[model samples]
Target: MAKAKWRSVDGIVLLNKPIGLSSNQALQRVRRLFQAAKAGHTGALDPLATGMLPLCLGEATKFSQYLLDADKRYLTCIQLGKRTTTGDREGDILTEESVPSLSDESLESILDGFRGEIEQIPPMYSALKHEGKPLYEYARQGIVIERKRRRVTISNLTLVSRTADTLTLDIQCSKGTYIRTIGEDIGEALGCGAHLHSLHRISTAGYSPENMMTMEEFEAISEQGYEALDAHLLPMDTAVEYFTKVDLPETDTMNMMFGRTIPSPVSLDNGTVVRMFDQGTQRFLGLGQIKGTMLRPFRLVNTSEFSL
Candidate 1:
């Protein structure tokens, strides 16, 4: 049989990644479903974790970085009393300690210490690079590498529920905040040990869980034909909806498209990033930054499909 044909499709697909599949595995499956010529995922989720995995197709990949830098939300369950090598249920038990009979007040007090800005040492069994190799590779060989502590913000951390041996939390954190580390730290604070039993991302970059589509849903839609699948693709501009918008005249839009800086028609702060669009045509031009009272193009979208 011949290889599958690829087409230039542009848009974002908010995928509800299921557990047990790495982010890349999920992306490839969705790419094949859409038959997209080019595709990429904004962020990665471990095989044991699941949640919203935004897939960018064609030109949408150009703006994927914006989403990567945005905040994330997750619901995590921690199994207290046992510490693990990987800080998760997948790791080997490193230590076992008796869990203390804890009260809401005491647990809340310990969690408050972790809120706001704090330092976290990256886990050894992680994708972080060490001398051009992943840290997990060294971890698999029983080689431990020293890692520097990086600052991350925990914007919101609230106790969702709890049982005798387990605690559930709803977390809203900045980019690079590891839920596994949070679980381990909380366990330590509680005078017991803990590891992430399960984690589910609820939102990221302003996209909520309700916007996500599961693989089964996408597969069912695929059977209806390509149009049905394409209908689920969000416009590329959705990636930068958080930025201020700056509409330009046709002439300035053309100039910016050609890499020339044009005088800003709107009053915006210097160094402000803005989403650019053609005022008359209402077509998205790209992204620009205000510098010295001029709008400089940072990234311009391919406009072959647009009449502008």
Candidate 2:
């Protein structure tokens, strides 16, 4: 067999991750398909959850944190009348209660209570760290750590469908929002315990699940040729489109490349991050911060392989 030859692949690939695989697992598979020299995912998805997992390849890894900080949209199913130890189907049932006879008006009212900014206690069976160890590890050892309530914005919460024992919800929330916790809170509001049955992330930042390719589709695409697989990759700048754009002339651009702050024509508020590009050819240079009247280089791109 020929020795594997890896190449610098720079861009973002939106993956419609199937349930039962961790986000890193999906990223590794995609990285192998592209033979990428570097790769990372924006955020993680539970093994039981499915949908959009953005994989960053090569230079795109530098901007992955922006996607992690972005708002998320999810469609989740909540099973009423049963509370679980881990807040989802993966854990054992803790208790069971009778689901209330709820009307559309009652359900809407309950959902309304959860809308807008709210406080949420992060689940113990989460990836959050405690004393340098993961909270899930402590949870597995029956260690209950006192957790503080955190503020999270739930911009939209709507009832999608309902049955006697199960209700589906569409939620759009800020970073750090816990959907499982919301399901439990919603159940508590209805006088019944609950847990998340299934979850599907529909959107993260500005990317949508509609544009994602599943693992199976990717496997088939990989068989065609490496070029075919590379075609799915979005440019590195795709992750930073929300930032204000600024183009610098050759003199200022060179100054920034050498770690010097230079005068900028853009009048953004001080401390605002902007995407810097070459004024003449429209090539993406890197990122800069507006400090007073000067643009200070923050994170600079390492290669010309990724350009706007």
Clashes of 1: 0
lDDT tens digits by residue: candidate 1, 156-234: 9999999999999999999988889999988998878899999999988888678899999998898877789999999
Please write out the lDDT profile of model 2 over residues 138-216, one tens digit for every residue. Answer: 9999999999999999999988989999999999999999999999999899888999999999999979677899999
Question: Which parts of model 1 have CA positions greater than 4 angstroms off?
Answer: 1-4
Please count the clashing residue pairs in each candidate, in the order shown: 0, 0
Q: List the residue pairs that clash in candidate 1.
A: none
Top TM-score: which candidate number?
Answer: 1
